[model samples]
Target: RVRAYVPYGKQWYPYFMRRLAERPANVAFLLRNLLRS
Candidate 1:
């Protein structure tokens, strides 16, 4: 399980993108949970 706190603002997208880029596994984890819901 992974958790994060991202302030909602103009910088949010870039911040999330950087995180996803840093770890491709994050993308897979996200998709897995999203589809499970």
Candidate 2:
């Protein structure tokens, strides 16, 4: 289901974008935690 993924307001856009751009690192961090369990 490919739909337009526009963010609602400008308030959280910057923070969300930054996290999205760093998704690889974020995933790695999560996976590391998962493996630690």
Candidate 3:
């Protein structure tokens, strides 16, 4: 349900904020990927 909603690299702060809010459970894992880009 969540992976479908993740933002691609081109998306910036707003995208990160939205996804984080939408899935706090995955914040750490998602943040790791975000930083890797």
Candidate 4:
């Protein structure tokens, strides 16, 4: 399953940080793909 969130305002930062903390591998995956481009 896939999920998406669109947070408005300054609070988006904390929400994104919490998500990265919870799924650390996602950070690595994102970096990998970013570098590949």
Candidate 5:
């Protein structure tokens, strides 16, 4: 699972997490900005 990978000791895990974590926020932010524009 993605959640499990985020906690384990892996080189790329944290990178994936940041990307994954920010993705939804970014999408929501974009949609709101798009509607305003």
Candidate 6:
């Protein structure tokens, strides 16, 4: 079993991006989103 907790607030996206920037795999995910936009 696995569980995750998510936080909700106005600042969530920046904080989330900061976290994703720390990992290489997540960088690809982030770039894909940027290109899509």
Best candidate per lDDT, number? Answer: 1
Candidate-wise lDDT, in order = 0.91, 0.73, 0.76, 0.89, 0.68, 0.83
Q: Model 4 over residues 1-37: C-alpha lDDT tens digits? A: 9897788798999988888899999999989999999
In candidate 1 the C-alpha lDDT for residue 30 amounts to 94
Evaluate candidate 5 by giving its C-alpha RMSD to the native, one decimal. 8.8
With candidate 5 superimposed using the best TM-score fit, by how many Å does residue 13's alpha carbon deviate from the native? 23
lDDT of 2 at 17: 62
Candidates sorted by lDDT, best first:
1, 4, 6, 3, 2, 5
Evaluated against the true structure, the overall lDDT of model 1 is 0.91
TM-score of 4: 0.64
Residue lDDT tens for model 2, 1-37: 7896566666677876677577778767867999999
TM-score of each: 0.77, 0.38, 0.39, 0.64, 0.38, 0.51
Q: Residue-wise lDDT of candidate 3 within 1-37, one digit each (tens)? A: 4555445676677887886789877888867889999
Cα deviation of 26, candidate 5, in Å: 0.3
Over 1-37, each residue of candidate 5 has an lDDT whose tens digit, in order, gives: 3554234456577775577587788767757999998
What is the per-residue lDDT of model 6 for residues 1-37, given as tens digits with 9 covering 90 to 100? 9988575699888888788778879889868999999
Candidate 1 ranges with C-alpha deviation above 4 Å: 1-4
- What TM-score does prediction 3 earn? 0.39
Task: Output the better candidate (4/6) by lDDT.
Answer: 4
Instruction: Give the clash count for model 4.
Output: 0
- Cα-based lDDT at residue 34, candidate 1: 100
Off by over 4 Å in 2: 1-22
Candidate 6: misplaced stretches above 4 Å? Answer: 28-37
